[model samples]
Target: MKNLDYAYLGPPGTFSEQAISAYCSKYGGKTHACDSIRDIVETIVKDEVDLGLLPLENSLEGSVNLSLDLLYKHSELKLYREIVLPIAHYLLAAPGVKKEDIKKIYSHPQAIAQSGDYINRHLSEAKIVYTDSTAAAAAEALKHDDRAVIGSIRLADIYQLDVLAENLQGDLPNATRFVLAAKADKDFSDKNHLGNNAESQFKTSIICAPEVNRAGVLHEMLGEFAKKEIDLSRIESRPTRQRLGEYLFYIDLMGSSEDPDLIEALNEVEAMSGYFRLLGSYPKTVIK
Candidate 1:
């Protein structure tokens, strides 16, 4: 078997690292750590690595905007597979500290957002500090006495922080969906078999900007999918970053891009929209 090199977001002990390790373990491959998701994607694009794993969305936090923005801006990479790992957040602190001693909570913005209700109820007087990653926040908490960090339990162990609490996020079935991406020509069909079966389910994503003053433009876009009975899975709008009121629409549908109905929908969308891009067709992540 050929050896594979994989890149994931890390200083280590991140949920991304855990997900990457789980995927690589089945294939006996080594995983490399990257500073950011963009770096991971760029590593694959430059042939510095064989694959890249990146978080796409979380069940509690909705879409990861940076990942979507990066995907929208980078056209050289392709989505090869996806994995959904159950999320279990922990509150970690230095060994001598107790849960009641914590005066502030720190974690990645997504983590903080996911655990909002819990934080509001139990740590109402605590301040929230957003860090780059859960692991990073935990590392910082290790050097402070009054701070607690929300992150993976594995991170607390790795950093030698005590677990003040477990499963801090109230979402019982919380999970994060990650994408496996590679350069345009890399074959992923084999790994597809090794990954989560949920990764094998078909899904297509596209981005578009509708023309202004075109009455029923949104309706027309939906009509293409509805006319063919194609189910729309998600639709989100993000600012174009060009100007106020100018926005781009990201759409996910339940079918492969190559499916006849999907192809026809894209064709019609291309004719009706000002600009459009097909993100990729890949398997959907199964939420547990």
Candidate 2:
């Protein structure tokens, strides 16, 4: 397959950059930096790149709602691949900066949230500051003697900062799941898909909204999958924005779209749903 271009959340040293770098190293691609998730989506929708990689969810933070919202708003985009990157946040600050001297903690909200326990225990007195990205937080920390950043270790080297603490995240198995999104019109060769082995499993994402908000309707809709024994990995609801209380459901199921049982279940769900969309099916990468 020919090398492709990818857009990822950036300003360097972010986990998003790390995720796409690892993927491109194996799959063959060039990486471009986008300032935000919306920027990544916009580039793909505009055909500015071959794919846009953005964080979909974090084990600690649950899900990146902006990613879900963007996927829902843009019908032309599809998830072509997903990668789970292990997270290890370090307390980084400029040389000569002491932990006791720190008066503020800076990081992207997800990173800050993931390291909440550590922050509370070690730097409880410090004020929390949110940045667009972890790398951006590192940039901000570089300028302030009393500020420290919680981010990837790479930030230390990139910003010439010292690592004051390592593995600061509260969770043992911290990770962020990222997905490569592409325009539906793009033709992806087999090489673009990973886990091609015959025994490989796949994951499918879909969006559905009930035709009516009757009682037990959500349960009834999910029953179709339950009856078929199709495993659902996740289900989240986002406001429809068309109504006061109505919502659109985003679901991730553990099977390929081509599976007979999944297809049957999906058809049933669609009939009962006023709005339904098959986001895409992609190879499932098991994270060790």
Candidate 3:
């Protein structure tokens, strides 16, 4: 394997950054930390780096819509790898500051959502302040004794903040799914066939928009998969933003795109869909 240049969402200490760190620990790479997921996606789309990593979904916080939207819009970028990182949230405050001394709480929105129960019960009086990243929240916390942040334990030492409380996510075993993306410009005759192998477990993601605004179209679309005996792992809807009721469907098929059955099924579905996109066909990484 080559030494890849990776981009991630961060100012360091974010789960996205941590995910890339874990991924590259065995195979070293330089990481470019972007301020947002869109930046990371765009960087990959533009081929500014060898790869990009993004937090796609969370066990507690749900799907990251920005990631989905960017992927849908950038059909040239392929999701080649996935990393499921075990995430744990912690509460940090300035040195010598106790939890009761904190009057305001700052963190990324997903961090806030994941710690909802703990915040409601323990820091109900604290004002909730959201930041772009958990590391940014920790950066903000360093300036105020009355402020606290909910983030990873890795952030405490980075900003010289004290761990006001450990595992503040209500003892839940939280995890985030991150995807590795790269440009899909290689031809099939090229070596590795764009990173494909017979032994790899694969997942193909696609975006579907119905051609006509009619009833039972979604059911009919799904029937195409069922009739072909394709197993869908996930299905999510996203607003196309053209109208109030109009939406786009995202689905993950539980097999490789190279499979003849999948190719046949997709060919039929594509004809009926107003717009359809094959985001990627890549190997699935299962983390222990």
Q: Which ten residues in a row have the lowest lDDT in candidate 2?
A: 191-200
**Could you give candidate 3's per-residue lDDT for residues 1-288 as a string of tens digits?**
455689988788888776677666644677898877778878877778878886677732223888887787777877777677877898998899998899999998878988999999899999999987889899999898899999987788678888877777766657788778888773333324223345667888889998986899989988889988999988988889776788899898888888898998898889999989887777754444
- 1-288 in candidate 2: lDDT tens per residue? 567899988878888776777776775788999877888899888888989986777732223888898898999889877778888899999999999999998888878877888888999999999987888899899998999999888789889999999998765557788878899877776654443435567889999999998889999999999999999988888898878899999999999998999999999999999999999988745333
Q: Per-model C-alpha lDDT, please? A: 0.79, 0.84, 0.79
Expressed as tens digits, the lDDT of each residue in 76-193 for candidate 1 is 7777667778898888898999888998888888888878888888898999988888887888898889999998877876888988777777855578878777776777567534
Q: List the residue pairs that clash in candidate 2.
A: none
* lDDT of prediction 3: 0.79
In candidate 3, position 96 carries an lDDT of: 93
The candidate that achieves the highest lDDT relative to the unseen native structure: 2
Residue 152 displacement in candidate 2 (angstroms): 1.2
Q: Give RMSD (Å) of candidate 2 vs. truth.
A: 2.7
Model 2 bad stretches (over 4 Å) = 59-63, 95-104, 125-128, 144-147, 192-199, 286-288
Off by over 4 Å in 3: 59-63, 171-173, 186-200, 241-245, 286-288
Candidate 1 vs candidate 2: the lDDT winner is 2
Report lDDT (Cα) of residue 94, candidate 2: 92
Q: Which candidate number would show the highest TM-score if scored against the true structure?
A: 2
Clashes by residue pair, model 1: none
